[model samples]
Target: MADASPKHDVFQAIADPTRRQLLKLLVDKEMAVTVISGHFPMSRTAVSKHLRILSDAGLVRERKVGRETRYSLQPEPLLELKRWLSYYERFWENKLNVLKHLVEIDSETGTDRTGPNRLKDDQTPD
Candidate 1:
């Protein structure tokens, strides 16, 4: 039987900026490597390497079309990433809520609850 697990980690595959852009390019349509490479400053071989990593991570789907290969986004794998990030949503919400409360207090009392060192909107760090 074939292994169900991906050869590469989704996080690792997307860690590189180039690979992330590759995913974005393929999001709307399938593309040949030559076409995809045109969007980057790198050589076609470098872009192909990035695509291979994405393919290993199951973030992209590849197929043969006549004499060329085509690639497209396979977003099902990203649900794992989404579910992992969702767990931290509550932490951010709590922090934002505390900041909101502090801002409200600052407005009422005419004081800076954010911190003593925070620069005002009109001020810049020097």
Candidate 2:
């Protein structure tokens, strides 16, 4: 049986710098493949390939206007990535808060929690 999975996920789609720039270009306006290709150094075919990946990821929507094919950004799929990253953001925040508290304690006690300057509780200077 054929694989039912999408050809590209949002992570894979945006993994390439070119594809990320393409999405940025389409954020405010849709453009035909020709116009989109003009913004990059690559050929139109290359741009189309990037668009295809974005389309597979549901990160872009394409429309046919007569002979031209125009593409636009579809940001809904990116919510998954945002949600995933937000969890790590909170994790880092907690770590940073702990470090901040350690720094504050070290300053008040005239001790260093890091490097060779760290001192034990009984080693305070006179």
Candidate 3:
């Protein structure tokens, strides 16, 4: 995986729910392609293609041991994704703060969130 940026095709690769599930499966343990394929309904070739994209993304480490190739998760790229998600979390926090002001909560939790009123307040009036 020479491409260092995770935004382009690699993000597209993980946008598919199936591909995301495959990554989760590899998280806990290294698995063989055959074993990984068995978890999904797709054909071996389709699974292989997904694996290739993941490898390109620097997400999976593919190793050849004699007759079979095994794959393990390389979590560094996922750290990038996590960092990206944290930014969204900050956005959510800001939105929550704005709502906090709108609602006039004196004892606020420092977020737009407050009790059951939150659900009704967030609704669009239209």
Candidate 4:
């Protein structure tokens, strides 16, 4: 039986700026390779390679229309990236909460926020 799994993960596919731009282009509507290539400075073959990576990662869908192949965004795989990032969101929220508490304490105590710990005008750090 043929393997049904994606050859590349969403994270790997979107690691490149070119591939990310390709995803953005297809988000609104599908486009043929020739049309898509016009948006970037690279050759059509280069754009096609990026599309192939996105397709391998299951982040894009391609269809043949006569002699041309059209590509569209397949956002389902991005859910994995979303879930991974959501996990870190809580970590950042906790840090923000701690900073808020410290600021509240400083306000209550009338502590100089611009004290020795902070940099002064014309003071450059090493």
* Predicted structure with the largest TM-score when compared to the true one: 1
Residue by residue across 71-116, what tens digits does model 4's lDDT show? 9999999999999999999978976776676677778988775777
lDDT of 4: 0.89
Cα lDDT tens digits, model 1, 1-126, are 999888999999999999998998898999999899999999999999999999999999999999999999999989999999999999889767766766676688898646776656544333
The local lDDT score (0 to 100) that residue 7 gets in candidate 3 is: 37
> How would you encode candidate 3's per-residue C-alpha lDDT over 1-126 as one tens digit per residue?
474564335567689888899899999999999999999999999999888888878888899988898999887777777878987898789778776665564455454445654556456322
Runs with alpha carbons beyond 4 Å of true place in candidate 2: 1-5, 98-126
> Worst lDDT window (10 residues) for model 1?
117-126
Model 2 C-alpha lDDT per residue in residues 1-126, reported as the tens digit of each score: 998676899899999999999999999998999999999999899899999999999999999999999999999999999998998898679767766767788789887567776655445332
The true-versus-predicted C-alpha distance at residue 68 of model 3, in Å, is 0.4
lDDT of each: 0.88, 0.88, 0.79, 0.89
Top lDDT hit: 4
Which 10-residue window in model 4 sums to the lowest lDDT?
A: 117-126
How close to the true structure is residue 72 of candidate 4, measured as C-alpha lDDT? 92
Off by over 4 Å in 1: 114-126
**Clash list (residue pairs), candidate 1:** none
Clashing residue pairs, candidate 2? none
